[model samples]
Target: MERTSPPLRTVARAFEVIELLWELNGATLAEVTRRMDLPKSTVHDYLRTLEMVGYITRIGETYQLSYRFLTTGGRLRNRSRFFQTARPVVRRLADETGEVASIGVEEDGECVILHAMRGEKSLELGIYPGLRVPLHAHATGKVLLAHLPEAYAEETIFSDGLAAVTDHTITDVNRMKRELSAIREQGYAADWDEQILGMGTVSVPIVIEDDLVGSISVSGPTGRVEDDDYRAELLKGVREAANTIMVGYQYGH
Candidate 1:
């Protein structure tokens, strides 16, 4: 095996604190220390440095991320050809399905929602652009995982520890391997109350020029998705949206 060095501990710690803050929206020193299992002094040093650098803001004993992160996301979204191409496709899928449709890509061992559209009947599920989700937790996530090289996929799962959000989440490695294989064979993936208790998603990979770019999904309440005819319509719409994105991307490029 080729040896690879780990990231510098200081840099990693900084990012760990940042991620904790993102997850919590804002955190007190004690909250961060308790959640991340880091020393208070260490957390304090990182928080001070981050706040001093204008990457975070401290207000009334709570530390929150600066708006710079949103600005960064907007800049990156503008530059992303995939995001540009997939945006309208997501909108159309939402319109057709009366659910929320999204396009997402793999980043740093997680799936990040790049764009999302909500239909008139869509329930606000709290999903949004720039939201990062686990690779083994949702439909888009499974699609992302199914498309990666086996070694890379396994590495992501091993490194992330398959953190379970619900009782239905797949936590066993061997079982997850089998699930990924099934997703690959099926060409699309479904989430039935795995990530959240009531939501369901059906996703298809957005492939461009024979390469997997990302996944498109139509997600809504499980009741709507459980209807057999409605499920069929949702799957068809999602797949068509993926095809449209691929065509638009190939043509525009």
Candidate 2:
């Protein structure tokens, strides 16, 4: 059996400090020390090291993340052929549907929005690139989950235990499994005020040569999304966008 190496404590602590700073949106040396329960000198050293590497910035006494992260994230996104190919298609879908259109992929058992574009009537739901959410709480997430390997999907679902984000969110494991099965058969997923109240979403998977690339979704107010005529239109738009992205990615366009 292959044994995995344990995580390095020094590196782990450094990441913890970074996450703490992110959660606080910036923190004084004293504040970091208090929150991390680490020695003041230790926290200061971590902060200084991160600052020296340009990952953190010191303004007055507050230490915050630097734009270096943004640069790194942008470079990573640019490297993804799938994301690059999906960008224009997703933007067009947003324009056609007049809602929030996004592409999402599963990472570390969670759904991460790769890119989100707002249309003329899109709601300001704080959806953005790099936003991560539970896989059972939204249309994009459900589509990705439904397409993933059975063992991996089962592990993710059981481990996460289906925490409810809103009253409409599915909290039962069996029910969620049934939903995934239906999604597989129907080739799409829909969420009505599940992740966020008043918001509705419809998503379709982007499959290339039987491989699940990711998912594309359109979101809007429940008032419009729940309407039979409008919902059908949105579903048609999202499905077409997903197909465009899949074909573009497969052809290396």
Candidate 3:
């Protein structure tokens, strides 16, 4: 079932004001008006509501975001149980494939790294827990995008816009759409130096309860990853690891 957004009201606008303050690291009322492109009166109303709710604080001449939002997002993340289930699975995939293995979840149309395991042999692909990467420039993003609802997929891609991070990155909207379609059919996405130089990666979506909830990935230097057999074996191991996590997710274990 599609989730319904909260009702649009003063409360919702107050939250948006807090987010903008957080993004700006605090701003004057004039700056907020310019960034939000709203009338001064409207911005002041939202700021007053947010201050009343303890979500933002006004100190002297500037408004600042409070830590309450951090607590809320942190609580939601801790309740997900995603890292606990993915840790061992990622380790196993790294051991089997002899490549860096990772598990990530989608948040706000971006990939948030939750767990990663490095192979015994050093690989140059840089990934670690808590590292966040944009969805437009990564194989992991492609897998997650391919599995999302069509409307969400289209909106994110269009909104984020395809700016080339590297020479090999897909920069055209139509090309990206076609690429995602292929990933959906093949059950995986691959990139050769698309985001970083001399690195390659494969990403596969993790499905549970018929929802595309996360992604599993294997990455290594181009020489090892470009080998056809090595790539195939890595994809196989990634799929197996994702399946393991899916089973764990299904049973609440």
lDDT of 2 at 221: 94
Per residue, candidate 3 scores C-alpha lDDT tens digits across 154-205 of 7765655788889988899888889888998999998878888888888989
TM-score of 3: 0.70
Question: What TM-score would every model get versus the actual structure?
Answer: 0.82, 0.96, 0.70
Tell me model 1's lDDT, rounded to 2 decimals: 0.87
Q: Write the per-residue lDDT of candidate 2 for residues 205-252, one digit (tens) a residue.
A: 988887888899999998989999998999999988887877778777
Point to the candidate with the largest TM-score: 2
Better model by lDDT: candidate 2 vs candidate 3: 2
**CA RMSD, predictions in order:** 3.5, 1.8, 5.2
Flag regions of model 3 displaced more than 4 Å.
Answer: 1-78
Clashing pairs in 3: none
Q: Order of candidates by TM-score, top first?
A: 2, 1, 3
Q: Which stretches of candidate 1 lie over 4 Å from their true place?
A: 1-10, 16-49, 58-63, 158-161
Residue 38, candidate 1: Cα error in Å is 9.8
Per-residue C-alpha lDDT of model 1 across residues 160-186, encoded as one tens digit per residue:
578887998888878887888898898
